[model samples]
Target chain A: MGDYVFNQRHLLGLADYSAADIRHVLEQTRTFREILERPVPKVPTLRDKTIVNLFYENSTRTRISFELAQRRMGADVVNFSAATSSTKKGESLKDTIRNIGSMKIDMVVVRHESPGAAHFLTKCVPAAIINAGDGAHEHPTQALLDMYSLLVHFGRIEGLRVSIIGDITHSRVVRSNIIGLTKLGAKVTVCGPKTMMPPFVEELGVRVTYDLDEALRDCDAAMALRIQMERQDGALFPSLREYHERFGIRMRHLEQYPDFVILHPGPINRGVELQSEVADHPRALILDQVTNGLAVRMAVLYLLSGGSRV
Target chain B: MPSRLLHADDFDRTIRRFAQQFTEPYDDLSPLAIIGMQTRGVYIAKRIRDRIREFRGVEVPLGVLDITFYRDDFRSLDKVPTAKITEIPFDLDGLDIILVDDVLYTGRTVRAAMEALMSFGRPHRLRFCCMVDRGHRELPISADFVGITVPTYTTERVQVRLAELDGEDGVVVTEGA
Candidate 1:
């Protein structure tokens, strides 16, 4: 297994990848993680390739992380924002991508409001497509990075209990994590308010619960997802204060579960999803998630570009 | 058909000779370190280090480097180059680094190794050591400590099998069409 190559061409979701394929990516990510610690922190592996960051939705961490990873690998990057692009003039998705496709782009990192927006690009363009976040469908890179951070902290993921708490109904992170963690032999539990919890979450091979305390009771790590206020149309919970009082991860929870670590997928609500003190605690892996996200994205882009070219 | 160039005994003698060459130049082996390229080079480096410790009464730091990320031909490859552990535990600021590899062909691996080493820190000096220097120079790079220099066609294959990895210690050349 010295030359374990990632066989997938596109990273649309974690469901498309096998357990060995996911492990291969996580193992390769260790190299990129070390590269970031080097004196130069750059490589020319992707110098000849040109990648386009096509964002049809608003984002901060994922966008910057992908761009940094691309630049660090010495790839030429083109940024496409939906608000400023031809999509604003009512141009269709296929037509806009086809226009950009003429420029000979090698890959496209896309985040759109509609689910399966990334999968749509593969049929229209020859470039490999990486789904940053497509509505509430799946964010493979974020989940992969989350798993990477978990592996880094605990040294293994198999047979570990993980609790994912927050807006499960509208969280792409939870969906991807459940699929990825389960494939790697992890037992996952999803905890959120009944309104926020998806109807068919148990079908994805994770235990569902409405109580945050029960979720974090016997787990190795707890991932607190952002509430995603923008994605929620009607109020999932009654109020932000009530939600914080009910399900927010506070310092007491840390004291209660001393053996478990905390994780959040960025833009943490100060008092809603996580207490300010808990977010700044030593056990919190939010910052590490950001760092690992870059490495994971770099690994994904490198593997996808190297994917079985005929 | 493949023809054997060096059997197990010959391989041991060549490694001991390389260890002697490494120790003869320096008054003190304190500043010297050995960095082995991924798989085969790692075992050869370990043998040389063991020999130096047994005869010269000095221990040298050994580091492992995987140059998959630093390769120049990533786009041209049929599959993604896999990576191994690159662990340089000691500081590389002023160490005299000797890069060890099993075979030297186009010298592209050496080029990538040199670049990869510089990323850690500025070493005092860097040199290359290889068991087999098969002549095909795509880059202007050559091994300083060579076991055997063989003149061969670009289509030929030079195989180095170590007992640690391949269950045998031998060097063989196979004809290619």
Candidate 2:
């Protein structure tokens, strides 16, 4: 069982992972989930381990959830937002990371606006690196947590259909989820406007369509992508209302398929891709996704820190 | 890997004997609880709990603890150590508890276990149980119920194997391990 471990120093992307590797994380996540429900949820497993949350981008849900996962596992966590750090004073990313490594950090949980920011730090420092999110490239932990919520509902990830809707072109979550879910034997289907949908997205082994009604039907799970208006380039959709009218998941869509597990990585636009009523639907695991995020991050941090192949 | 300490027959008697003396001071097992440290300690704790039920006719609450994060020598480990899960099903407030483990050496695991236990709640009393109390004391903590004591050299390692996990039940001494 020890060899059934996450034998890696850095979690850069799901492209390097196998189905077994993802399953190792899910197995460990089951343990953390049980631990979270206990009276004293905290464990001393990572007690002496020290980690730094080095986020180059702005995030609340990702940053705070990683911080809580680290602390709940009994590790000393230091939060380092790049905006308030020496980087604003003209220090290079390498210099800042080297200086942080000089303090003898064990691991770094990083989020950056630029892709490969975490991959760059793996060579600059001795500490393990966990990519919280890197621009539009990937968000592996989000994928793992989303997969975990699905595992809780479907009892397995293999042989299930999951549809992803909204701004797939700019979504790091969609990219990572595609890699991870497909590796674990789940079929992914994506739907959005032609401009919002990336070119040749079907080449990544998913069915792509522009029809929301077709996208919403006959799937085990549905993950509504948060329309990244802040990160959108060149007005992909005409307006938010038109986008909602075309791709927005309403109560009726879920009513048609009662067993469809609903998921959304939040800072959710209630009326955008998902209707406000459907967001509150019992099938929506949006809030459960948040709760499972802690367990999944805890599993990722624990496996990366202690169960290293090195 | 060649030396044997106790077999299934002697192991069973030693546990029952320890249960008798350990419960001699208490009238009722209702307020008593059994907690095992993670890995092998949990297996030992479960057995002791079963023996207590057979002897005293009471079902004691059982808990499992993993103290990997509370170890004093985490920095000293050559490689990163995997932290085990800590599961305490019932409240630890004001109950008499017996902490169980297979082998006792260095006293560090017990000390760490005590610190982890305190985070839950203060028990009315805390007691320790060990199947083999091999003497290599780094701390003053000692077991309250000892099934057997075997003294060995620093170069050797004492291994306790249980059928539940290790595919057999026996204790062994590995020379120069």
Candidate 3:
């Protein structure tokens, strides 16, 4: 048997990838790094393949990046906006995905607001599924991009201290990053307000703390999660000013560790979870994360499409 | 089919003969360049370049041409071929470029490689070099500098595994059923 079997059809969580599997994907990404520099900037690897993007959530970067990655790999890309789809007309999510699957899609990249929506669609459609983002459950592609960014910056994944701060309970990026970072041998810690922090998050093998200052000290890198304003109305925090005063990473909090790098899964609220100065710091890799997002997503799509079978 | 095996010493002797034949004073051409079709051919060109550099103080400019997309038998490969990196840090314009490969068989690969090379730039003169020139030419092409010529029947295969890639230097011939 091969060292790994890709029998699992959908990527719904970072927990799906083992250390070996993540390493394989990263190694494949290194090969694809060269492909991105070509004049034509595409490979005929997935020629004649069809990839459908089903996004129920509003997105500017993730949806577009996934579309571009699929098209660049020689796959036919179909964008399904849920706002105008049959789902808005009383058709069930299952029925809509089934109807699309009936048209012969090779893969489905889905982004939905409800948690586990991608997992549910995977059961409905037989096509290979990639979760772009599904509510506060998981955004695995973001985590993969973060991992790729970390690997590029540090040159190795093992033996590093990574702290994820702000809205741990509500940030799908945190859930995925915790799983991805820990699996790659990096120690992960989650810090946020007690109300915003999820109960038993430590059971997932990440250290949880309520003090941002304690977590940020002497860490290799820190990723600030965006506070979901939509969820703030339900008593997640008392006030925006209180949240920023306590949990928001600012220039002073960053001074606790001069060697640390800052990251944000953006559409970042400039003053909410992270300060503007900290987000734009010299060591901040927020933009690099966005640039690496394309390369990493391309790597994932290429590998999941059986590019490594050669 | 019982074919004669050329030992390592015999292989070295063949390369020496080709070097002597091609390195004559009359064959000294200006702006002599060597380009290898990547993967196996690149190593062969490096060896020839090293030998030439030893005899003369001037080192020839080396280039690597990848003809992966231009292959005629691409469909026969079970999966998409991994793209090999093509590194040609020197200009090929107006130079007498000698294309090198490990083995010359059907000549289709060479033809495809020549087409691919032309896309990069036009060369002043073009010549072919091969470590082993087996007797099978499906195209109207021949190698100018040959290390060894091996006579073989249709149902036979000659495999060359170089130390740089395969961890050993050797050649093997096997009968095809």
Candidate 4:
């Protein structure tokens, strides 16, 4: 009875995915993960396909993970960054993408500063569009990999207590994680400073709290999001040290909450979002998240390429 | 029209014969390993493995291969294929591998399996074994050890039902699209 079917093309956000759809993607990720342990991890599944990585914003992990996944699947990849491209010559997003589309691409993995930019591209080109991150709206691939890490650790996501810590207001990660985890029947609680917390995030079916201790109290898993120092220049918190003292997951928190494990969508501010020691602890899945990100991104590209349309 | 070619009794006798034929050339089966293609070939491989152990008192390492990623006509398929795990616990270096499958038809699956096997390591030699050698050869490949050969139209299907998967063991022919 493992007849799970996932027919979605573009991975815009978790808000568009159902529980079954999420499960199917996770299941496929497990298969893809096994390939990484092989001598020849590369597969020729996407040999005939060409993909374009169009990044309007800067990134390290997500971009690299997507590129590695695409290349490993034997796909022809073209990398484009808006900072060094025709965008500097005052070219609009529509004009730029349409021009790239003229080169005949099968898919586009995009990260944009404005929300709905990925959704807007779906109407512009025939190629499938995947949202690497779209402003503060959603970073779906991050959330999927986060869920995959949790699944690898706890063995299941349903009925598990997950606490997401830090920068909910500016995080596309938190938005996507909240939607994805809740859809899979996990209890989600977001912990951050009052200014860092978004308005009515509880409306998205998550518990909002200012107390870090209360959030980590009974949770099975805790994901500490990166404090977006680059995104918020208006001083949302008093200082990095004070924020760490108040909300950062330190070594003490790891010892105190022995049951709950740790995760971080990384480039961790060593002493800010999470303590340096806690990030290296055995309970921390920060590194596993990176490896799983490659697998999850591969699964997303494989599924969205409409291989099932065969 | 659907017709039965062989029943469960025939399957038992054919598998035992294959085990007997396996030991005719080699005194020691240590250099040999069995690899079954995914789906039905796995069950056939297991049955042959059991018979070999009973006949020769030597156990060979068995591995399963899924060739979905190595398939040439992935774009022409009706659905995207999910790849299964290729778990070959032992090293393939300097070993004679016996690749098993339920049917030998267009020989495309054999080609894919051979390509998929190379990723592991270089084998000393590789041999093909199939339960049925159905007519229609699209590739220059043939089985070294065949249970039976049945010539049929290109539109006909050869259905090899194993007890492990289909609740019975039999070879049947049916009309197909």
Scored by lDDT, the top model is 1
Q: Please list the residue runs of candidate 1 whose C-alpha ends up more than 4 Å from where it truly belongs after superposition.
A: A1-5, A307-310
List the lowest-lDDT window of 10 residues for candidate 2 chain B.
B74-83
lDDT of 1 by residue, A250-287 (tens): 99999988989999998888999999999999999889
Tens-place lDDT digits, model 2, residues A1-310 = 6575456667999887888888888877877887788656787777767899998888999999999999998899898998898888999889988988888888999999899898999999878889999999999999999999999988989988999998898899999999999998999999889888888898999999889878877788889989887797588878889888999999888777677878999988989988999999888899999999999999888777753222
Correct interface contacts retained, every candidate = 0.65, 0.22, 0.04, 0.43
lDDT by residue (A163-183, candidate 4, tens digit) is 999999999999999999999
Q: What is the DockQ of each candidate?
A: 0.63, 0.30, 0.22, 0.52
Rank all candidate structures by their lDDT, best first, as comma-separated numbers. Answer: 1, 4, 2, 3
Report the lDDT tens digits of candidate 3 across residue range B1-177: 535466666666665565555556435545788888777888877777777777765577888876654566643544334445566666567877888888899999899878666655677888999887887799999999877788877788887667787776666678987
The candidate scoring highest on DockQ is 1
What candidate 4 gets wrong by more than 4 Å, as runs, is A1-4, A307-310
Backbone clash total for model 2 is 2
Q: Which ten residues in a row have the lowest lDDT in candidate 1 chain A?
A: A301-310
Weakest 10 consecutive residues of candidate 3 chain B by summed lDDT: B74-83
lDDT per residue for candidate 2 within B1-177, as digits (tens), equals 479999988887887886786678889777788899888989988887789889888888999987765677655554445556677889889899899998899999999989878877889999999889989899999888887899899888888889898888878888983
Residue B54 Cα positional deviation in candidate 1, in Å, after optimal superposition: 1.9
Better of 2 and 4 by DockQ: 4
| Candidate ordering by DockQ (highest first) | 1, 4, 2, 3
